[model samples]
Target: MTHVVTESCINCKHTDCVEVCPVDAFHEGPNFLVIDPDVCIDCIACVAECPVAAIYVDSDVPASQRQFLALNAELARDWPVIVRKREPLPDAAHWADVTGKIDHLQHP
Candidate 1:
């Protein structure tokens, strides 16, 4: 099963997970990241790399965040692939522990 990047990642935009992704399945957005289900190999390599614990196996995604499964797939189609790790957004530390920040996700 593919992994899903959840709402906890929306504003934080941490790239640690992207660096561990062997398949380069990660897609970068203006302020978030998504895993392309089509390209993911279920390696689980990126899960632990997420500082916010935002990455989860498709089956392990919590019920409250299940929407991320579809969101990841949808966004991955258009967002550019991100294969290298980069610093998180300047306000990442502030947003990392914030709950329910999905509305803050930037599509551009």
Candidate 2:
């Protein structure tokens, strides 16, 4: 299974996890990231690297956030691969803990 990037990463957009992905499965978006299930190795390396705990194994995703599994897959197809770490959004700290952020997702 692939890992999913969920609501905690909405505005945060932390790239710490991207740096740890061995297969380069992470994809960048305007203010978030996603994992390409087709390329993800499921190594679980990126999960612990997420500062906001936004990454989760597909089966472990919170019930409320399960949609992220499909969301990641869908967005990964359109977004560019992010193989290096970058500065997070300016207000990352402000939104890292906020929940119910699906509405804030910026689709590519």
Off by over 4 Å in 2: none
Model 1, 44-67: lDDT tens digits are 999889999999999999999999
Give the CA lDDT, 0 to 100, for residue 106 in model 1.
89
Error of 1 at 5 (Å): 0.2
lDDT of 1: 0.93
Clashing pairs in 1: none
TM-score, each model?
Answer: 0.97, 0.97
Best of the candidates, lDDT: 1
- Weakest 10 consecutive residues, lDDT, candidate 1? 99-108
lDDT of 2 at 72: 92
Superposition TM-score, candidate 1 onto the true structure = 0.97
lDDT of 2 by residue, 1-108 (tens): 878888899999999998888899999999899999999989999988999999898999989998888899999999999999899999999998898888999885
Candidate 1, residue 102: lDDT: 85
